[model samples]
Target: MRLRRARTIAAWALLIGSIIGWPVAAFGPARHEPQFVLGLSFLALIVESASLLTASQVHEETGSK
Candidate 1:
């Protein structure tokens, strides 16, 4: 249960981080390459997937009869 909660929090943080950071890292005043944006997006997807999986586990464990 704790693990699920921790993972869920981490996933939310990562999701928000990627959302805010992507624009800055990829297309900010520094002007990064397209590959950088793509990579960040890919990483975000991975984090999201993990978050969803953990959340599913938590739901299953505590689900109604």
Candidate 2:
């Protein structure tokens, strides 16, 4: 479990979770508020972006593609 790999996995998980969760929250029987769902999605995206940036930096420091 390298840091880069861990971050990459986390980023992917967040992205996929949001992709699936957004629709479920929007159109599913739960009927969550749109603002709440959008807030959560934005937060997930920000965290995912940070994780990816960190992973990229790690890869750059390690000189690995």
Candidate 3:
């Protein structure tokens, strides 16, 4: 039960973070602060990917084992 809840929270966080980070990348001085903007975008992508992967894992486990 606890693990399931944790996974749900993580998945939501990842999804939300990705949604929030895109605009910052789009309009936040991309050229002058390429590294920072790119880093945020990369992190957002990673989190989004991880969220999908973790969702599949949760589904496969089906709260069993």
Which sections of candidate 3 miss by over 4 Å?
29-61
Residues 1-65, candidate 3: write the lDDT tens digits.
76667666667676677767666665675646667757776776877767675775677478666
| Residue 44 lDDT, candidate 3, scale 0-100 | 65
Q: What is the C-alpha lDDT of each candidate?
A: 0.66, 0.67, 0.69
* Model 2: per-residue Cα lDDT over 11-61, one tens digit each: 667667766776666677556566686767657776776777677667756
Q: How much is the lDDT of residue 35 in candidate 2? A: 67
Ranking by lDDT: 3, 2, 1
Q: What is the lDDT of residue 23 in candidate 3?
A: 63
Quote the positional error of residue 61 for candidate 1 in Å.
6.6
What count of clashes does model 1 give? 0
Show the lowest summed lDDT stretch of 10 residues, model 3: 22-31
